[model samples]
Target: MGDNDHSHPFFLHHSDHPNLVLVSKKLNGDNYTTWARGIHISLSVKNKLGFITGDIEEPSSSEDPDTHAAWRCCNDMILSWLLHSLKPELVESVLFSTTAQAVWDDLCERFSQSNIPRIFQLNRELATISQGTSFVSAYFTRLKGLWDELASYNEHCTCSYGAKNDRQ
Candidate 1:
């Protein structure tokens, strides 16, 4: 997706994390399931997957000052990255968040709704596709775009090797 390069730094904000692209704008949205999967993998890379899963808690002020500071820095960095990656309208909602997990949870709760109808609609369109009068290459490209978008909505096993195999 086009936004992948932008979201990379946020997930890799931690000095220890690997440098790699995450979700791009085209693959991120309420319309599909790819966003969640991409976020999961990104967080995993940073060893901060617990933030979204709620397995980890924000460090309290009463905790060790150094540990608390580090946690806050990491959370703030992640929140900043997420805020930067979102559309302007979406940014307003999570802009005030102090914890990265809070923003992630809010987004998930807001968009993770049943999308059965959208899936069916995409399927119907895919079924009706035809080369018609268009050149074969053009038709194939259009069909592949639809298939890629459809695949984004339906998460499946992703190959970790090769650019073409790595659908995420």
Candidate 2:
């Protein structure tokens, strides 16, 4: 997706993950579930980010938390998790998002200017990518609002059309 042009960037560092996790656990009644949404994102891009080949999860069967503070912490952890987990290839361009403003501010504070510029660029490119209706992109359009809010997966785009479309 290369046409969209609205990117909201924040900063992140590699060391914040475990500290966030521990702090999140201490204050929350339902420790893991508090961070469930962020964990979901982590699980989806586990391979894309590389270093995090697997999930460090929350209990799906438990009661909901009393507040969203745990989720806030989870979002922070997800960044650390991705930075530490991504394979070298994707590490330079990983993007973080959430509806929450606090999380956004946290990100802006952590990453250096050089770490993930591609992520910001990708958001700007997304509107264009969203316009394509290729077979695969069509599939995404069909699924966008149906399967767990497609907006959550910002990096996904229409699949490349094969050799017939190739430039000479």
- For candidate 2, write residues 4-115 as lDDT tens digits: 3112111233443442332222212122222333543544433212112222233233464522444335445555553443334433444444322222223223321222
Which portions of model 1 show Cα errors greater than 4 Å?
Answer: 1-21, 26-29, 119-168
Off by over 4 Å in 2: 1-66, 95-168
Top model by lDDT, which number? 1
Error of 1 at 25 (Å): 1.5
**Each prediction's TM-score versus the true structure:** 0.57, 0.21
Q: Candidate 2 — what's its lDDT? A: 0.34
Error of 2 at 39 (Å): 9.9
Candidate 1 per-residue C-alpha lDDT over 12-56 given as tens digits, one digit per residue, 9 for 90 to 100? 332432223356652235543566666677667766666555566
